[model samples]
Target chain A: MDMQSVITAAIEAVAAEQGKTLRPLTDDLVLLESGLDSLCFAILVTRLEDEVGFDPFTLSDDVYFPVTLGDFIRFYDDAARSQAAPTLAA
Target chain B: MQHAAKPLRRWLLEAERGRGRALLAPGTRLTLDALADTTGLGALRGALADRNVLVSTGSQLAAAEALVELDGLARRIVLAPPDLKPTDIPAVMAGAGIDAVLCDGDHPGFGPDVLIAVPGPRVPLPDAAAAEVRDTEWVLLTSGTTGLPKMVAHSRAGLIGAIDPSALAPVWGTFYDIRRYGGLQILLRALIGGGSMVLSQAGEPMADHMARLAAAGVTHLSGTPSHWRRALMTPETASIDPRVVRLSGEIADQAVLDSLRRAFPGVAVGHAYASTEAGVGFEVTDGREGFPAALLDADGAVAMKVEDGSLRIRSTRTASRYVGGTARALADRDGFVDTDDLVERRGDRMHFVGRRSGVINVGGLKVHPEEVEAVINRHAGVRMSLVKAKSNPITGAIVVADVVIERTFPDTDAARAQAGLKAEILDLCRATLPAHKVPVLLRFADALAVTPAGKLARHNA
Candidate 1:
């Protein structure tokens, strides 16, 4: 499955487990405003890592906190690509 | 001779005829007489006399042997736990003024003036070596609010003030390592209380220990709540039956108490409030979570009262003083040891909420992990749980929980069943606890980590 679909499914799965209804998962959807709660994001990342083979938070040295659904998905996608093919440091 | 002046070897009691009690270790067993053996202890006593000694043995079994022999010989005996970090050993040695090191074997770790004695079953003690000597101060290490271990000193009379040894001649077993206060209580009980003790192996498996306890016919067993939870998980728990079960060192939540009662039908399952510093406060055997409110008002040897949610006990049972380091006074001017365990009054009973220092700051509110864990553990699916804080930019920190499922569900609907259990746990938390105390992140674990002290490890995720 594509990274976006996988990430979306994981978020839905975690929300379903928590009995929470998410505001529509869209590119510009702000996570803080959504029904998802703080620290529940850990469950999302854990589920995502099991399905997809990477946890973006630990793989990259750069500190980044994604604010939107798109940013979250993009971060995981970039982490996966970088993990699969290491690029030379600029 | 006074009991205080007598060594633990003198405390050893032998049952009439063939009923002699023994220290039953996994690979070996030593009867009461063997424990009283002065074969090598005669010269060893002279060498260790009037010295500040550190017992850093490799095993709990060795510790028992060392403690029995060294109790009266040394001016002060400091117990070094088997898992003492290498980095912290020197500080411990310096703090307690540990001049001599006693070990089971040769040691490069202790210091230059190392004394060695291989403790095990030996020849019967000679009658001449049984004479009592000067009183020795028993020093125990407590990891107080300050992370570093502090040396707490106690007298023989103080340690035994609360233990009313049984007349039934019961066999004792414990999940606690004997170096710690909880485990040391059991060893003392077996020695002076006319019972045999089954000591847990240093790195033995839980299943193996339970099997050993069963083989030794353990009539009474004691451990922290964490140990009992893990024991309940092990299959051998069913075979290892005891007449009486006890819990100390950690909060005994309703879930574990009810579970123990269910596990051992008609057995006397009790929980006591005891610590390295507070000694033994009281025992509640009515199968309740906490002690009765009347206990506080009642006149007893141990005077207890809750001040600002923390339980304070003033009694002869409490450790006398902080032996070394710039440690704060063990007791206040009123001679009360601040237990630092927070308890909440619910009707007539005061349930232990959590440690006063272990509170997790959830936003501006405080959440005790033990309280959250109690709520989560009440769920039938959850065998055990650890509630910890997860750092969040939004709320400073948020509560997170890792739950260990009691049993495996069928593969056909396992995922669904687990999800349903998680939802139920969250619902239970919501119904019982405040919103801020509710765990935001929940994940199932195969097993939760327990520390060497046999309490739940609560490192933030």
Candidate 2:
């Protein structure tokens, strides 16, 4: 699946968990401003781990914190790329 | 039948005359004299001479000293935990009508007139002040809610009514901090029985506290089911050997009781049912999850009945009222207080069915989240589980769960292993519970959030 669709599905999952319906999102949307506080962020990350794979934050070798929803998608994209690179080369 | 009641001070003084030790600290044993000589006793008694005091302290030793000294001086005492946010203190102080604080800081906005600095020279209460402590209320704050702390008032007699004057004086240890209701009961039970207690510090690490209890040779230990679960997860718990193990403040499932038996061989495990609003209700000594159904009509001191799945209790030991707040009768005109704790009759016993308001309704069928959580928690890989309700169009609501995995695996294959565990959990639930009760969605939380009172935070959404 493409990164954009993957990220949108994860966000939708979190919103459903909170009993909320989210408006369509854009790349420039700040994650902290998405009404997801520290508590909701924790649940969101948990859901992301299940739908996608491991938490991108824990999988990456270097420290990378995402600020906007676009950055969050890019972070996951980079981690997925790195994971695939090892298999592609073999 | 017209006997006069003795003051709280007199009863404590009589207990102090016994040869048993009063407190067991890390390296020191405290008799009643040593307890009286704890720092700032004189200053506390002096400040509490004529007015009510808000005793908010982080130190358990200081709290014990303040409680005894306040009672000795016939001073009205309200216990407000110091860990409360600065914003919540003023309203609590106002509600309790507190005139002074025994802590060192003016953080509660209680100026010089209110703050009583400890570590000052000792000044004992004058003999006249100890004449009689009557018509005084001991106010305790509830910990579960987010709004203003609910202030509960209990008469001195009512507080100690259920404490049997047994000659056995076993050293005790408790997981509850003394500020909360569950902790206060253990403290009073030990003191009134002329026994020593290893007080658990508020911010101390559980492993460290368990080590201290081991060092103090804690023979009697009581805690909530959550506390026991956490303790059993660590190796430090193996150092302590308790003869009398009591569980309260939450439901004691057979899993926890069986584990306790395995951990401490030959230990007598008992679970008691009590709350801050409702005094000591009843105890089940027969290693079971619920009380015997026969207790509803048993000629016990406390009368109990299950009405509409909620336990109603009527006893002389029930608390007086909420001071300065509307007094909601815990019982009906017949003196039965609706405890709000839901229970279901299972054959010969009544099993706890969680809180009434917390139940998850799935397609008009009632599902107790605690019951589902209990079943999930029994799984070996599950550390803790929170069963919640999710809105669905077809079925009014659907059951879901968030669990913390206790076992760790390689980082490369963690998700796959977690998926397997989730499958196992789902299979177990399907086999044990009804179709409607099984969780449709099971997610993994790094750690489940617990309430300040050490209970699982349910239905956060």
Candidate 3:
């Protein structure tokens, strides 16, 4: 799956677990505005870690402060691309 | 007859002179003189006087010493424990009127303020002069887990007055241990009692630190229910050999209290109920179910009336005013400050029903989150739980539970395991709690949202 799809799946899994209906979580949608409270946000980070290899808890400082969903996705996409580039070079 | 100077400053000074040892960590020790030279408190006093100084160092020892030094110089110091995001900084600054910000970590580009990038045990520069001010000597921010955090400002005398010498004597001997406010108070008491103080780093590994505390032969240990929960879960916590273990910050439910008593059979288990705005009021150490209520007068309310039901304390330890706000005048009209906590009086003792704010009006009945959270936390699968009101069209407001489950069942299917856990938790709650008190919805996670100080953020949940 593409990075956006992966992110969407992660968000959906958290929403499902929280008994929240999934809305179109755009890159611009603020995590707080996405009907995800603090607990759900923490769950979402955990789910994302399961899907991706790295733990997303470290991104909390960034996510809580200035970063938005779009910012998070871009960061994730960049990291994914960098990881892939090494294999491609090999 | 000339009385001697306060023992707190004297002990610090003696520790500085290398007559006594400074307990940095468990095995790591420093002379008081060395600590004094390293923290640069003398220069800090000269540079940043009455100005609202923010001590943002990551080290607990440095931060604790800075707080003491600032208190000594009569500087209104706001101790911002590490892990505070830059986003939350502005609101704290505005509320407390912080004049300068200091950080031990690499500067995160926090605007134009003089960002002193000094490490611990380094000499403080005298460039920043202390401000001549004295409205609020210390402003502690409430862990804003719900909404915007509130600043609790205490005057120098008021803060010191809040300490009860006898209450702390049972747990800590010549050594002082405290959790949150109690920790600060213990530090103050060490100074007053002519004792040595040990400091714990905020975010270090729990097991490692507790082992250190065990090796240091700590006499006193204090923390909130949540801190104790994490400590109990720690493998090394079994090794701690403190003479006293005290709990505060939140309500001490029976299960957790019982567990603590069982764990530390020889040690005294005590609990105190107080707040940032009200300061310390009621203390219970005899393993009581609840704290004794404040004494009431002939008028059928609290006898020490300052306002409404809020505690009207006349002790010399009361904060002069809310920092950055107007001076606090006792609302003697009722002769008591309404504590906002609903209580049931049993002769001289008072059992807490719930805080007026913490009570949830579910349909016609009222429920307390603490009661529900206690039930949820009792479940073995649940690591921690928080209960709050979510807007509901049918009930107006419904109770919701957010829980963190233990990692033992990590490999189990998330959906199936969560369903089973929820069912089990709901069943337990139904059996013990009132129908309305049971949470309508349950949210599970690997971890709960915690404040920098390791407190569950109820407001955010």
Best by lDDT: 1
Ten contiguous residues minimizing lDDT sum, candidate 2 chain B: B1-10
Ten consecutive residues with minimal summed lDDT in candidate 3 chain B?
B170-179
* Reference-based lDDT, residue B350, model 1: 89
Angstrom error at residue B294, model 2: 0.6
Error of 1 at B311 (Å): 1.8
What shift in Å separates residue A89 of candidate 2 from its native position after superposition? Answer: 40
Clashes of each: 2, 4, 37
Compute the interface RMSD for candidate 2: 12.7
- Candidate 1 vs candidate 2: the lDDT winner is 1
> Top DockQ: which candidate number?
1
Rank candidates, TM-score, best first: 1, 2, 3
Model 2, span B1-461: residue lDDT tens? 11115544455556546465766554555565444434355534565665677887767766776676676454578887645777877777777777877764334457555655454544544453453455556888876556677778887777778877575878889988777788887777776676778987756778998998988788989888888877887789999999899998888887788788888888899999998888889888888888999998988789898887799888878777777655455457887778889988899999997987788877678898889988998897886788998754335567789987776778999889988998899889978997678776798887776665667766534
* TM-score (all chains, Cα) for each model: 0.86, 0.79, 0.66
- If ranked by lDDT, best first, what sequence of candidates would result? 1, 2, 3
Model 1 CAPRI quality? incorrect
Give the winner by DockQ: 2 or 3. Answer: 2
Calculate the i-RMS of every candidate, to one decimal place: 4.8, 12.7, 11.8
